[model samples]
Target: MTATASRHRLTTAKAMVDGIAAEMERDESVIVLGEDVGAYGGIFSSSTGLLDRFGATRVIDTPISETAFIGLGIGAAVEGLRPIVELMFVDFFGVCMDQIYNHMAKISYESGGNVKVPMVLTTAVGGGYSDGAQHSQCLWGTFAHLPGMKVVVPSNPYDAKGLMISAIRDDSPVVYMFHKGVLGLPWMAKNPRSVDEVPDEPFTVPIGKARVARAGSDVTVVTVSLSVHHALDVADRLATEGVDVEVLDLRSLVPLDREAILTSVAKTGRLVVVDEDYLSYGLSGEVVATVTDVDPGLLRAKVARVAVPDVPIPYAHALEYAVLPRPERIEAAIRAVVGA
Candidate 1:
């Protein structure tokens, strides 16, 4: 079974869950496991109706033991099942880091290529709905730092569906993050009722490839997850002021699509990375370093990063917005980079 060629209208979150469900329907080896994944459809309904359609055997619910369940997913993957484990929230990943980074990620390599763990661990990250520090932090950097794992953060529904498919099919473990903030945004939803032909097939967008969402000749704005939409918003607002900024969505972080980053940087000669994670030792920093390391002379100005402040996410709404990178801040960074 494959993705239907037919385009459908679905909320970003709904589309992602549906995409995973579709994959499960297509492949017998596919199974979903997590607390409430079977009955409650996951904490966010990202796995809603999966158990009803696939039955309890495929969409199994587990106890609230992250380490045990995550390890179980890894073991199941090694034994041939494609397990899609829901971590509920990114903050909970710490409890199972050993299973993920130490075991799942290294099993294939440690076995001299004899074993492969094709698992997908989906989790939610970021702030906006006031979920607080623990539930709202973006921890992509931690997983991206691990060499044997593929880190994916989809900014919209289209990318979410495509990337999730890729993650499920990947031989190694993949950490797929669905940002909580952008899930309900209408602009990213698929048009399910459209009369256009939607193919009844399953397809995947290759990992490590970045999409140039909005092309421009001015400074390049590189970002991923919720930042992509924010950057695009800022780009639109900046356009009125004659700042034609190009927006590149760094869809997959682990593969680190360096070519896309380099090309965009080479074109604009000015780069601003807007990331939700902390500025220091985050994806933003890595991108800036990549550009300068590749060709320092190509830059017209110092690379800038608009990111969450180096502090824990605050519980207060105003304080939360203050720390998380906003469109205005991104615009400022872009302008600073381009000297506009």
Candidate 2:
């Protein structure tokens, strides 16, 4: 009952439908196909009350046919079944990118590993409510630059019920990605930090680990889902303008925690990456080539990113927050990488 008071009763889409109803009540092979996840639980309510407790044959409710229920959830996770598939829109993944990037992410390295998909696909990405450009994109770097999945991206509801119970007890394929403005959606636009406290029981947030959510030495914003609440509201408005921002939070982009982005840019030598996807080859140029692939002299200036520029997300909520990365473009890329 403690873990932050069981997150005040859940809402990053009800802690991702209580981590897919605690892995479908401790795995009766964890099924849950998409579109309105049974009895209308997930048009982003993310499986609310999971079809009155997993009835209707493990909460089945498919038909919008994203490539035939994501190719029957990758042949029910390659015949073993731990599926949680729900791609209800990370801009529809181009009507099923061949059942998510070629067979729920390359079916266990093309079967040399004797197939074990173990799936968790869930979706619903970003855009501040205009939901235009084919329902607003946050492609999570086109499913974390393809290759057998584990993309995650929970930025609240205690890492969305511990990364949806560690992406339903991962065996391989994951790609979770939440952020329809952090899923507090009572018709969007009131994200009190994606509703807090989470942890009623079944826990686990470890999947590449990057959580320095707000500690600072000067400027490091990095970021993930919902731009990690727009870099923690521009690290609490640039810490009252003195600007000691450091907000990492890369909660798994196909295991891109790269030593916590080089230990938060070696303790904030300044690096602002805040991405709601788009703005060049994604995830803010792979977190600035993961800190210049090791050490662009650990940044001193010129690293700011604040994404969404590659255009096409407009339905006019003032041109979709004029290409979101919002908290005023992550406070002008964390005060222009701390040159303030």
Best by lDDT: 1
**Model 1: how far is 334 from its true place, Å?**
1.3
Clashing pairs in 2: 7-197, 7-198
TM-score of candidate 2 relative to the true fold: 0.36
RMSD of each: 3.4, 17.5
- Name the lDDT of candidate 1: 0.84
The residue ranges of model 1 lying beyond 4 angstroms of the native Cα positions read 1-5, 185-200
Tell me how many residue pairs clash in candidate 1.
19
* CA shift of 85, model 2, Å: 11
Worst lDDT run of 10 residues, candidate 1, spans 190-199
| Clashes per candidate (backbone, < 3 Å) | 19, 2
Residue 242 miss distance in model 1 (angstroms): 1.2
The candidate that wins on TM-score is: 1
Cα TM-score per model? 0.93, 0.36
Residue 293, candidate 2: how far off, in angstroms? 4.4
lDDT of 1 by residue, 1-340 (tens): 5543456655567667767877887899999999889888877767877888999999999999999999999999999999999999999887888998999899989999999999999998888766788988998987898889999888877777778889998998999998877676443332222112222346677888999989999898999988888888888898999999999999899899999999998998888888898778879889988888988998888888888888889999898888888777887788778777
